[model samples]
Target chain A: MIQLLRTLGHLTVDGVWQVGFATRFLFAMLRHSGPSFARFSLTIRELYFSGVLSLVIIVVSGAFVGMVLGLQGYDTLQRFGSESALGSIVALSLLRELGPVVAALLFASRAGSAVTAEIGLMKATEQLTAMDMMAVNPIARVVAPRFWGGVLSMPLLAAIFSTVGVIGGWFIGVVVIGVDNGTFWSQMANSVDFREDVVNGVVKSFVFGWAVSLIAVFQGYDCTPTAEGVSRAITKTVVYSSLMVLALDFILTSFMYIGK
Target chain B: MNRAILDLWVGAFVALGFAALMFLAMQVANVSEEGTRGETITLRARFEDIGGLKVKAPVKSAGVVVGRVAAIRFDPQTYQAEVEMKVSAAYPFPKDTIASILTSGLLGEQYVGLAAGADSEMLKDGDRIEMTQSALVLEKLIGQFLFNKAAEGGSK
Candidate 1:
C-alpha cells in the first residue's frame, strides 16, 4: 500500500507536468494559426451541435432547478418572515454558479465524451495518419474547431439555463405559490448586478468550455489503436473534464472574491 | 434531401422560439427596468452585510414590493454595504422608516425589507435610511447556537 501511494504521487506529478506541456502547445498552435478562418467556420458547425442541439436538455433541467429552488427557498423564508427574497436567491445562484457549472457538466457528459470518442476512433483507424500524410495538421483541423466550438457554445447554453431557470422559479414562486409578482421581480432586481455576478457566470462558462474541449481532444488524440482504448478515452475525457470544471470553478470564485 | 432541409428549418424555428421566450422572461423579472417608471423615488440603506443579494432583488413592505434595489456598493470607511433602492412613488415612506436585511426562507436570498414608521415626514430621493439591519448569516447563527449549548453543557 505504501509503494502504491508513492507511485500514485509520482503519476499525479507527471500528469500535472503533462497538462502544463499541452497547455503551452495549444497556445503555440493558436498563435501560429493566425486568424484560423477555416477553424472559425468549423467552430460555427460545432456551436450548432453543442449549443443548439442541447437546448431541450438545458431548458427542461433549468425549469426543474428553478422550481425546486423556489419551493425550498419560500418554505424556509417563511420562518424568518421574509418570503419575498426568493427571486434574488434563485437569480443570484443561477447566474453566478449553478447555471454555468451544471450546464457545462451536462454538456461534457453528453457531447465532450462524444467528441473524444469520434476523435479516438479516427486516430485508431489511422484517419489522422492520412491527414498527416496529406500535409494537414490534425490539431489545427480537428482539435481547434472543437475547442472554439465548446468555448462559444458553453456561454450561450449557460445564458439559456439561467434565463429559463429564473423564469421557472418565477412560475412556481409567483403563479403557483402565490408570492406577489411585484415582490419576486423586485427582490431579484435589488439583489443582482448584471455587470458583476451575471458577467462572471458567462466568463466562467467560456473557461469551462475551453478546458473541457481541450481535455477531450487530448485524451482522444492519445488513444491507442484499439476499440477498448477509444472507449476508455471517451470515458476518461468526460470524468476528467467534469472534475476540471468544478475545480476551476472554485479557483475562479476564490480569485474573483480575493483579488478584489 | 427536401425532408432533411424541412426538418432543419423546423429545428431552427424551435430554437428561436425558445430564445425569445427566455428573453421575455428576463424582461418580466427585470427590476431595474420596472424602477424606470415615472412614479418611483430612490433611497439608500446601509448594512453590515448583504448576503447573496442580487441587483434585481425586490424591496418589500409587509410582503409587498414597495421598490427594488437599484445598486449596491461597499463603504471604504465603515466597511458596510450601501444599497440604493427605488421605491414606488405611490408608497409613502416616513423619514424614520426602518430597513432590515431579511431572508425569504431558511436557505433563501437576502433582501432589504422596509417597516414604515408613524412619523409624518416623508423620505426623499437619495436620503439615507438610518435604521438598517444586516443579514442574519445562518453559519454564524449556527455557530453561536452550538457554542451556547456546549457552554451550558460544560457548566452543568
Candidate 2:
C-alpha cells in the first residue's frame, strides 16, 4: 500500500510537469510561425465546425436546463412569496457558470473526442510518420487546426447556451408556470450585467477552448500506433479535458471573488 | 467523392443553423441598443450592500421596467453604496417615490423596486430619489432569527 501510494504520487508529479511542458510547447509553436494568416483561416473553419455545428445540441440541452432551473427555482421561491425572482436566478446562473461550463463539457465530449480520435487514427496509420519523413512539421498541420478550432468555437457555443437557457427560462417561467411576462423580463434585465457577468462568461469560454484543444491534441499525439491505443486516447482526452474545464472554472471563480 | 460532398453540405447546414441561433439570441438579449428606449428620468438610492448589481440592470416600478441602473459607487463620506437609476418617460413618478433594494426570492438576485408617492410633483430626468432601503441579506437574517430563537429557548 505504501509503495502504491509512492507510485501514485510520482505519477501525479510527472503528469503535472508534462502538462506544463505541453503548454510551453504549444505557445512556442504559435510564436515560431511567422505572420500566420493561414492559422486565422483554420480558426474560422474550426469556429464553423465547433460552434456552428454544435448549435442543435446546445439549444436542446440549454432549453431543458433553463426549464429545469425555472421549475426548481420557482418552486423554492414560492415558499418565500418571491417567485418573481425566477428571472434573476435563471439569468445569473446561466450567464455566470452553467452556460460556459456546460457548453465546454459538451464540446469536449462531442468535438474534443472526435479530434483526438481522428488524430490518433492518423498516427496509427503512420500518416504522421510520413509527414515527419518528408521533414514537415505535424504540429502545424494537425495540432494547429484543431487547437484553433476549439478555441474559436468555445465562446460562440457559450453564447448560444446562455441565450437558449434564458429563452427557455422565459418560456417555462413566464408562459408555462405563469410568472408575469413583464416581471420576468424586468427582473432579468435588472439582475444581469453585460460587462461583469456576460464578459466574464465569454472570457472563460476562450480559456476552456484552449484547455480542451490542448488535452485533445496531447492525448492524440501520444497515442501508440494501435487500435486500442486510439480508443484509449479518445477516452482520456474527453475525461481529462472535462475535468480541466471544471477545475479552471473553480480557480477563476475563486480568483474573481476571493479578495473582493 | 459523393459521400465527401454530402458531408460538406451537412457541415454547411450546421454552420448556418448556429448563425441563426446566435442571431435570435442577440435579438432576445437586445444587444443592438446601447441606450434605453424612450425618454429617460434619473433617480438615486443609497444602500449598505448591492451584491452583483450592474449598470445595465433594469430599474422597475411595480413589475414593469422604467429604466436601468446607470451607475453604482461608494460614498467616501458615508461608506455606503450610491446607486443611480434611470426611469423611462412613459411612467411619471411622484416626487416622494420610495426605492428599495429588493430580492426576487429567498436566495435570489437584487433589484431596485420603486413605489411612487401621492405627491403631484413629477420627477424629471436625473432627479435623486431621497427615500431608499438596502438589501436584506439572507445569511444575516437567518443568523438573527436563529440567535433570537436560541435566546428565547434559553429563557424558557
Candidate 3:
C-alpha cells in the first residue's frame, strides 16, 4: 500500500512537471511566432496543411449538423405552434454551442493529430537533432508555425462551421420542410444577439485553438523517439484535446453566459 | 506553381471565413447598428423596476421592431430605472405611445412594446415616453409563493 502511494505521489509530481513544461513551451512558441510569421512560406505551408485541409470536413459536418438542427428544431417548435422560431432555434444552437465546440473537436482530432505525428516522426528520424546541430532552434523553425497556424485557423473554421450549418439548416427547414424562408431568416436575425452568441462563440474557438495547438506541438516535441511512442502521442493529442475542449467549454460558457 | 495555387486557395479560404464572420456579426449579431433599418432617434422612459431587461432589447410596436433599448440608469431621486431607447426614425410613434416591458413565453427575453395611443403629435428625438410599465420580477412571484406556503404552515 505504501509503495502504491509512493507511485501515485510520483505520478502526481510528473503530471505537474509536464503541465509546467507545456506552459513554458507554449510561451516560447508564442515568442518565436512573433515577427517570424513574416516568414510566410513556412507558416502558409503549415496553414495549408492544418487549416485548408481541415476545411472540407468542417464544412461537410457543419452542413449535416445544421440539417439535423433544422429537423429537430422544427419538430420541437411545431408542438408549440410556433414553428416560426425554427430559424432562431437552429441559428442560436449552432452559433452559441455546436459550431465552436464541434469544429474545435474536429480540428484537434484531424489537424492536431497530424501535427503531433509529423513532429514525432521528425524526432524519431533525428531530423530535429540534425537541425539542432546546425545552430538551428527546432521550436522556432518547427513548432511556432504549426502553433500560429492553428491559432489563426480555429476561429475561421468555427465561422465557416456556423455559416454553412445555418445555411444547411435553412435548406432543410425551408426548402424541404416548407417553412417560410423570410420567417426563418428574420427570426434568426432578430433573436440571435451579436455579442452574446456570435462573438462569444468565436472567442471560444480562438481559445480552443490555442489549447489544441499547444497540446499538439508539445506532445510532438516531447514524444519518446520511437514508433510506438509517436503513435501514443497522437492518441494523447486527440484524447486530451477533446477532453480539454469540452472542459474548457463548460468553464468559458459559465464565465460568458451564466455569470452575467 | 503549387505554391501560387496554394496561396490563392488560402487567400480565398480566409476571405470566405471573414465574410461568414461578417455575416454573423451583421445579420445574426446586430453588431453594427449603422443602417439597421435607417436612422434612429434616442428616447428615454422611466420604470419602477427593470427586472432582467437589458440593453439592445428590441423595442417593438404592433409586433414590429422599431428600436432597441440603448441604456438603463437608476434614478436615485425617484428610485426608478430610466431606460433609454433608440427608435428608428422610419417607425416613429405618436407622442403618447405607451411603452410596456412585455416578456415572451412564461419567463423569457424582455422587450419594450410600444402601443400607439390617440395623439396627433409625433414623438421626436430625446422625447421621454410618458406612459411606461416596468418588467415583472420573477423572483418576487416565487418569493410570494414560498411566503404563502410558509404562512399556511404556521397557521396550521
Which structure is stronger by DockQ: 2 or 3?
Answer: 3
- Pick the winner on lDDT between candidates 1 and 2: 1
| Weakest 10 consecutive residues of candidate 1 chain A by summed lDDT | A32-41
DockQ of 1: 0.12
Every candidate's fraction of true contacts kept comes to 0.09, 0.02, 0.63
Estimated TM-score per prediction? 0.68, 0.70, 0.85
Positional deviation of residue B54's Cα in model 2 after best superposition, in angstroms:
8.5
Model 2 spans > 4 angstroms off: A32-36, A39-45, A257-259, B1-156
After superposing all C-alphas onto the true structure, candidate 3 shows an RMSD in angstroms of 5.3
At residue A18, give the lDDT of candidate 1: 80
lDDT of 2 at B9: 47
The order of the candidates by DockQ, greatest first, is 3, 2, 1
Quote the positional error of residue A4 for candidate 1 in Å.
2.4
Q: What lDDT is reached at residue A165 by model 3?
A: 94
For candidate 2, write residues B1-156 as lDDT tens digits: 254554564466446545634543344344434245767777777877876676666676786666778899999999989998877777888889888877765555567888989998988777777887777777888899999999999999
lDDT by residue (tens digit), candidate 3, A19-39: 999988878887787534778
Tens digits of per-residue lDDT for model 1, A1-260:
99999999999998998888778867865764433454355555666666667778887998999899889988998888788888888888888888889998988987788788888999989999999899888877776776676666777778788888888999999999999999888778756665567668778988998888788777888777699999998888988998999999999989865565
Question: Per-residue lDDT for B10-115 in model 1, tens only?
Answer: 4573476357334533453353454445688889988888877766577889987677788999999999999999998888799999999888867766667999
| Model 3 Cα lDDT, one tens digit per residue, B1-156 | 399988987888789889999988887665655334668899899999888889878888887777888899999999999999998888768899898998977856899999999899999999999999888788888899999999999999
Residue pairs with clashing backbones, model 3 = A194-B29
**Which candidate has the highest lDDT of all?**
3
Model 1 docking category:
incorrect
